[model samples]
Target: LFGYVLILVLVTFDYKELAPLGYILYGIVILLLIYTGLFVHTIAGTQRWINLGFFHLQPSEPAKLAVVIVLASYYSNHDTEDGYRLRDIIRPAILTAVPFVLIMMQPDLGTALMLGILFVSMTLFVKLRWSTISILGTVAMGGAFIGWKFLLKDYQRRRIETFLNPEGDPMNHGYQIMQSKIAVGSGQVFGKGFLEGTQGHLHFLPERHTDFAFSVWAEEWGFVGSVFFLGCYFFLLLWGINIAMTARDKFGVLLAFGLVMLIFWQAVINLFMIMGFLPVVGIPLPLFSYGGSSLLTTLISIGILMNIRMRRYQIKT
Candidate 1:
């Protein structure tokens, strides 16, 4: 498949080659985000994709990876043992904010939220002063208030409200979450057997293959299967983290860690959303979700992790 081919091509070259191009790619994605907002028509009520003929390329999907690379490259170059200070983080903050603002304008809260988490993840990896953490935490709360008030779309607000009280609007905004909970709970201990799930088979679950992909999966596979499914991701993430710890260079370390965090947050958010612990933010369940862009992004990120692992020792010669 194309995913296999992308990983193959990505590992054939040194991932360090990406260091110089991080900002370039980030800039291009930022432009694409702006272009999507200005010219692209809304598909499914979101201007987050481009008509790439064969595929509708979602800029926000790649935008997450872009932030990872940019932050990794920046941190690798400017690292200090004492940890990052207030002044040290300003540029990285701006780099993160640019795409955050642009994508938020498209009003894709999920992707925008991912970007913020990406920045925090990478920044924490390098370590942050308590002063910096407190400052950022306060700012984040303020920003959330602003986002809720003026930035979130009506439907997005409804999703949050529905998260708080699904029964309050069970037929309207609450339908997705309610159905998701049922599908997951009905799976019981072992599941309904593969492709035998009632919720998805009866067509009651919307976005069954996208945002709610895990719900359909859980319905079919049951609790045991769900744990087994998550176990796979657990190993994949741990492998990535091991690679980051073992990588020979600072760039390789940061790159591997940032990419792993990218996968981590997406998977966690999607899982929590489906289980009713978090509002539906439209985050795909990584490789499981039926999305060309999300799948490829996850694949390429894993490839980069492999690339770092493969050449972790070759840097000396």
Candidate 2:
């Protein structure tokens, strides 16, 4: 498969060689985001992809990798033992915010939040002072409140509202969450078995094969199977974190950490969305969701992870 080949190629490739081109790739993705907004095909109400004759490419997918490499490269080169000062985070903040703003303009709140979380997650490992962390944390919470009140578009706000009270708009915005909850609960402890889930099989569940893949999966697999799937994800995260801890250089450490959070956070959010605990923000369930861009992005991140793990040792002179 192409995924296997990508991991093979990146594993053998030197990560350092990609280091210098980090900003270049970042810039290219930024351009792609802008181009996508201005000229790419717009479906429904979002402009988030480019038509390439064969397949539509979502710029935000690659933008995730670009942000990781750019931030890792910057952090590895500029790290301090005592951690960063308030003034020290400006450039990295800009690096993250630029894409954050651009992607948000496409109204891709899910990916934008991922970028914001990526920056915060990486900064936590950068050894900042406790006082600084407290101040930043407070500011971040306040900023989130403000963004929710003012910056989020109409539908975005409605999604959050719907999550809070699915009954409020049962026939419209809340339909997905309401149906999802029913399907998940219907499975109870033992599930209804494969191809036997009434909610999904009978079409009561929306987006059954895509955003609601978890709903269908849970309906068929039951509580035990759902727990097993989550256990696998837990191990996957642990594996990436292990690689980050043992990486030979700062770049390798940050790169692996960023990629892990990228997958980890997206999966967490998507899971929460399906359970009606969070708003449906259109985040795919990584490898499980039926999406080309989401699958490819995950594969690329895995490739980078394997690349870091493979080169975690010094070469013999």
Best by TM-score: 1
Question: Over 4 Å off in model 1, which ranges?
Answer: none
For candidate 2, lDDT tens digit of each residue in 53-155? 8887888988888988888998889878887887788798899999898888888998888899899998887888887888889989998998898779999
Give lDDT tens digits, candidate 1, residues 1-317: 88889999999998998998888999899899999999999877878889889888999888888889988888889978888899999999999999999988887899999999999888887889999999989998999999889999999998998999998998998899999999999999999998999999899999998999899988988989999999999999999999999998888899999999999999999999998999989899988999998998999998999999999888464
Q: Assess every candidate by TM-score.
A: 0.97, 0.95
Candidate 1 lDDT for residue 69: 90
lDDT of each: 0.91, 0.89
Q: Write down the TM-score for model 1.
A: 0.97
